[model samples]
Target: MTATTTGGLPVALLLPGQGSQHPRMATGLYSGEAAEPEFAAAMDEVFTAMGAAGKPLRADWFAERPTVPVDHVTRSQPLIFAVDYALARLVMSRGVRPAALLGHSVGEMAAAVLAGVFTLPDATALVLDRVRRLADAPPGGMLAVAAAPGELEPYLGDDVVVGAVNAPRQTVLAGPEAPLEKTGQALRDALFTCRRVPSLTGFHSPMLEPACRGAEELFASVPVRAPRITIHSAYTAGPLTHGDVANPAYWARHPVAPVLFWPALDALLSTGDHILIETGPGDGLSRLARRHPRVRAGTSKVLPLRATEHGP
Candidate 1:
């Protein structure tokens, strides 16, 4: 069942982070008429684990309009994680073996679990704790900047940090709201587009230090193991070592660390002309991957399963 391929090219699964979630994003995957048995069962396992952990997921993911807005990190994170993994299972059930896995931000939870680094329950527990800590962090803002990391460097101070480098020109900045706005204004002045991200707290920056600490404490109790599949680390921007995957300290660094998506994508493309599939809801990651020079130069194709028709 794992031999499925479009053109004999190995497949790489790309999982999106928070901002990619939308209302009823899993509707197509879980509708009675379309539901795959493995997807449904995987969701059941997630729900059961959530219930037993006493941190029951309350959002109606199938709602025509999600009761929990996309900006609300607490409800959004676990829901997105659940849906992403369920969708990934559905894809695999169809015989698409993921030769490698790359996930952005919270999406890494699904990648980690699927890679056999942790059980569903342990991952759910970790997600719950991580969300709690992020909720406790000081309020901040994030902006998507259409400029290179070097061009944006002069604008960064103690309050500003590069949150993510999604592509060569697409970088995300996180910090206080005022600083973010100021930086955006500066970018606009320089003829670069800068849009505010729909998030209440700035993640992947020093602002999350306290939250990172709490995450470390939570991860200490959860068992970590070597991954059965290849998982490109957004933190390290390359393949993860068994020691890196098994260390709680390494996992803890993810929250406060900048997501090195550009370098990681470079590393993945350097391997070969691989097929890149966004295993989750939105095609944001896929779109970014398409912009990579290697993907454009090589014969690789990028497909996003159940992705929104239009995305950033």
Candidate 2:
């Protein structure tokens, strides 16, 4: 962590979730004016860690086309984590130190590693283990629903659950594909905009209990340290305690837990005069941060590092 200058703008770094990933997402980061040696070094460290774990990230990420589809959850999850983690390091290398950090879904794994909760190797292993278990999980799907969770609960029964609460009006539903398709149609008929997310696993629902259970041993084997920086958690939807980060049980359950990003964004904005930077490939976090009442009420500025036409 870098020291904050007196009277400098307080910045919050945002790490994105799954949907932010793309083919060769890392290529542009290495050539930009904002690029730094540390960024490339961090990429090396990440790839080395992945290779040591028996999965070479560079071969897929830098290939003409990925040998394995980049969007496959098994591959995508770790690749996104690596890109987001490297980008965050790049930003910090340029002296844009964040006073706080926040990560959505798989992004939290990178957040934990950034906060010093786990070494890069340990975090990589944990992600791979979780994805491995989920690959065997039953077929399921997710739906992006443009409605409040409370308004949509009637549609959620045994087979469906709220996967994420992204905004006051935007929520995601997760469950078996059959039921999710039916629910998406009903929501569309009710004049709510609904779209099926391109995912085969119903993450954040009870359907992932097996994956969660399978991760218990891996989570326990990993060593943890208290965070060196403040990191708001989507899993807890608030500031993370040392205990929260240190507990293997909390991590094991994270996959099946709803991503409470809306509340987490509120928590970040409540801190005075924040500049929220989306440190990954997309502007999703920036878009969500701008929607918060605090940003609208004039306490924060939302910025996107990767989306700008010019390098930082």
Each candidate's TM vs. the true structure?
0.91, 0.92
TM-score of model number 2: 0.92
Q: Spell out the clash pairs found in candidate 1.
A: none
What ranges in model 2 sit over 4 Å off?
1-7, 31-36, 52-56
Backbone collisions counted per model: 0, 0
Which candidate ranks first by lDDT, i.e. highest?
Answer: 2
Look at candidate 2 and give me any clashing residue pairs.
none
lDDT of 2 at 282: 78
